[model samples]
Target: MTKPDPIPARLAALKTTPTPELKKQWRELFETEPPSFNRRYLESRLAYRIQELAYGGLKPETVKRLEALGEQLDGGNITLRRIRADRDRPIVGTRLIREWQGVQHVVTVTAGGFEWQGRPYQSLSAVARQITGTRWNGWTFFGLKNHRRSA
Candidate 1:
């Protein structure tokens, strides 16, 4: 007889498990009280913990590389890290196309900033201003903001 894998079943049960049960599992796995986050967060963290324990975690080299990358991103400043993390900048080489006044406008995300009509712009809001001659929220103008209602 061969041993069956229990990870898949455990992960599947997370969706149907009650919040209290999920918290209990979190406490047992993490050996600490879970943060006061939502049920989805609890389930997701618990799932990751279960799988990490069953298999393994990232190698030391991978952890070091990720830390180096983070330092490069924010120079180890916690506030800058949070701000950069929250900003959903589009990937480089992406083309953002919008139509205004019956004319099509295209902006290309570059490594340094954005390029529109063969001109470089430091920020999307600046690009928006050039496009519309008025102040506008770039994310909203580009339709990237998540339209979710907060309770």
Candidate 2:
């Protein structure tokens, strides 16, 4: 007879397992401290880890291809990579709209850069400069900056 499948049971247990126990399991499986993210993040990552261990992770070539795509998006700039990694970076094909002095401006996000007023710019700051005739922080001018709450 074939051996029973343990993967299903393992994945199911993650749903009911206590957060501390999940962290312990994460330590054992990932060999690192668990991130300070919420319980749902832990559960999902633990489930993926269990499945990855049981089956396998992505192939090396696939990983390489993904990395290459990421590099193309960030153009190998460390600062750009950090910004691109941010959740606030607008996705490709997003349209950012802003009105300056009662004149409406629209910018389209592209795979390589941004387009505004029939011109392509490498950075949103350049588009903002063109709109306002002054230098501006793209994220702030575009209202993408993360706002922190005070206690």
Q: lDDT of all the models against the reference?
A: 0.82, 0.84
Encode model 1's per-residue lDDT on 1-151: one tens digit a residue. 9889989999999999988888888889999998876677788888889999999988899999999987887788988854563455677998998898898999998877889999999887889878887767776777755742221
lDDT of 1 at 37: 63
What TM-score would each prediction reach against the true structure?
A: 0.52, 0.53
Error of 2 at 62 (Å): 0.9
Top lDDT: which candidate number?
2
Cα lDDT tens digits, model 2, 1-151, are 9999999999998999999999999999999999866788899999999999999999999999999987787767888755644445577989999989999999999877899988899888989888887667887788866652211
* 10 residues in a row with least lDDT, candidate 1: 142-151
Model 1 segments beyond 4 Å from truth? 77-151
For model 2, the superposed segments whose C-alpha errors exceed 4 Å read: 79-151
